[model samples]
Target: MTLETDDRAEAQPTARPSRLARVRAGLPRTGLAALCGALLALSFPSFGIWPLSIVAVTGLALLTYRRTLKQAAWTGIVFGGVFMFWLLIWIDVIGYDAWVLLALAEAAFVMLMAMGQAAVSRLPAWPLWTACLWVTQEWARDRVPLGGLPWGRLAFANTSSPFTPLAALGGAPLVTFAVALSGALLAAAILALRARGRRAGVACAAGAVALGVVGYAVPLPTGGDTAGGPASAEIALIQGNVPHAGMDFLGRPMQVLGNHVAATEALMAKVGEGKLPQPQLVIWPENSSDVDPYVTPEAYQLIDGAAKQAGVPILVGALVDGPDATHVMNEGIVWDPKTGPGAHYTKQHLVPFGEYVPFRSFLSQYISELKRVAVDFSPGDKTGVLQVGPAKIGDVICFEVAYDGIVRDAVTKGGRVIVIQTNNATYEHTDQPDQQFAMSRLRAVEHGRSVVIAATSGISAVIAPNGSVIERTQLATQAELEANVPLRDGLTLADRVGATPEWALALLGLAACGFAVWQRRRQPK
Candidate 1:
């Protein structure tokens, strides 16, 4: 052969490997992370497939594996950006700018989680440590600057999954741990399958399958489970449709109040006609009476009339011109048919910007949204265990249900059943209500209490002790959900354990990171 032919032949021999190298190059880290995030977002409410969460976490683990902390953080940011962007899209109803800002803020937490994940990624059974790290990250996220937004938690998404039983064992934190662990286990399975050892691959596959089987066998308490102490109370949940969608509901305050009052009266008429059983307690959604019943005589009379008609104690949600004129109190008032408003539970966890502007002195000048709030809503200093008729209901207003501690406190303080009073009028037909409903389901299992939700713009629901939806109303529809909810006085293991499992899991994650660092230092320079 000639010299020219020989050179061409040499180049041809190297062509296949170069092509193979190009093909073997994986997707960009951020791209993979974003894909993982999108998958995870799909696992939550409104698009709840649940199993997708495991796959998403597995994909994220692979992307993060052996990556530097900086790279892992970037991966987390991309992942969170995609996930939060989709999960919190309902916030766009308020403003696109606000939604984007909130998503970015939440993504920062994910970045922190990814950094910690990178630290322990080198450890043995790294998936287990990584899973614990997830719990820790969530734990931190749930309570940070301005008492973190607990929306989009893993436990909330797994409310209807086979893994929901785990909540009874260790509360939402445990459920979150189980989800992260399963995802990590799945990642391990994938890793093992790709390894050279056939036996390792088989073992991991078997282990993962076995765990899933075990999860199904977990003895979750059902509706048939006895309350043992508190008797079952017939409850009514009112979801009076708003006059108009969006913030317009705020403008027609009296119209909103009239709607709830009318719904309650209609429910009473059903009872009078022997079409429906008389409820021991009638619950109204938050902002059911935007005008303070205590201060506004007409509003008070409207609520009183409804209670009298039902001939039952009515739990009315009211926005009261508070102890100070510059602020208001979002309250759940216990109104007796015989008497007026008595013991009330003021909302403990107020929405940061929606209710009150944080750093108001500075933010008010720059952001027009602050002006919309007008007056701040004050946070109550106590738990929301309310005495209504024969039962004590744990009343959490609107966004308070997202906070684990708030719900748990009421149960601990002798709330036999959980009640969530919310006004989703602004977010009607959005994923917002669906997501909140998911939290109620998880809380039901966590505390082993029947949860009754009263929403102003529908999605009102009665969740069983086992996290099953007994009954739920449609979005933006005028409806009432009535059920003989078992008043569960008994506390599940989750209630008793409180934050221990979360703290322990967090410690394990930190220990793994410490060990990883020590091992790295011990290695040859």
Candidate 2:
């Protein structure tokens, strides 16, 4: 009887061992997903290992392959949470809680994206669907609760990569699609290879290589006079160092304003001595004058003096008290040497919570930090295409550069050049400056116009139409950059198409997800 029982036990399968194996299998995927997130973060500026972005995307595609909805969602959380936490670590300067909450909220979008990715993984041309989903996620995230934060985009990582020229074709969305598609194709190649499908693997691999190198074939006008005429403008960018680094970088009431005035005066002095060519217009960074020039006489006098000294128009970024007592305006004012503050562009996209609290009456009761922003900032009704001197330039203030619509509006509305006025004193010495600068480079190529960035506490640059840096300033330095940038009136295909590619690609992704669900339902139980 004992021998018979032993024989039966030996023949029976062990349920515990099988369950253990399943659990062990899940751990590696989770670990790898986390690693993928970290790698993606490193692909961004400061760390800037561009190829890592493609690798991370490939790993994510493989992780979600054949995964259940629940499994895919969990993998996304692991990946997105890790990625955002590291990418926005600079937010910790505000508060650790704020950083965590923002990271969690951003990761939620990625979690949903992962669910869609998993759903579509079974479809034919799954790699294409996956790439579209990436664009869809960015589209949603770019405009949502509080004008969604558009940081950590895949296109931003490829600003200087071979895929950069693709920006001129369909803007940032197309570049993102190319990168994501390449990574997905790599994943497909890997899967086929492991399955011993040599022909399929080779085909997928070739497809990825083709996508990666095809950008070089695209024509990008980086030469003189992109407008088909001998038209160019001499521009100057001013980087006025702050008194100190942090939220209080402005220091004394007129300290920040004085720094900018001093820098402008120094540049003018150089021009006076014939050390440099006279600029047609000079661009100052956002918050170069924290106090409203209209409300404060001292600030007005200082700015007026600097503009007159330059003997040209100075695009000065300032906080102007306005529309109401409770609201302020962040504006880029054209201060001509003859006429003080002629035309101005009010910043359209205001930074939520930083510029204004969303639910002041309710949230302020719980979070006392909201008290710091005593007054709210109002949004502008029009695009920032203003005539500065002889050039019609588009002015995007600080974080506004990250928004595709804002930047595209300027170009489509007859902006000859692009100007980015930023103040990075609060986030100085962090990856934020480098990331913003990368966006400027991409914008140059996207619109086929010269991009001039003026940043307080540094990273001022002059970017060519082809995304080359003609001049750049270091962080926390008081410096001036002069460049003869070409004036391009003709818009790229991206400018003409606007958000069509993004919307179409996003819709396709959603359709794939729906079809995937329908397919699963049609299957037998």
lDDT by residue (127-236, candidate 2, tens digit) is: 99999999999999889878999898899999999999999999999999999999999999998898789999999999999999999999998755545344788999
Clashes by residue pair, model 2: none
For residue 475, model 1's alpha carbon misses the true position, in angstroms, by 0.9
Top model number, TM-score = 2
What TM-score, to 2 decimals, does candidate 2 have? 0.95
* Model 1 pairs whose backbones collide: none
Off by over 4 Å in 2: 1-25, 224-230
Any runs in candidate 1 off by more than 4 Å, and if so which? 1-27, 223-230
Give TM-scores for every candidate, taking all chains together and pairing residue i with residue i.
0.92, 0.95
What are the Cα lDDT values of the candidates? 0.82, 0.90
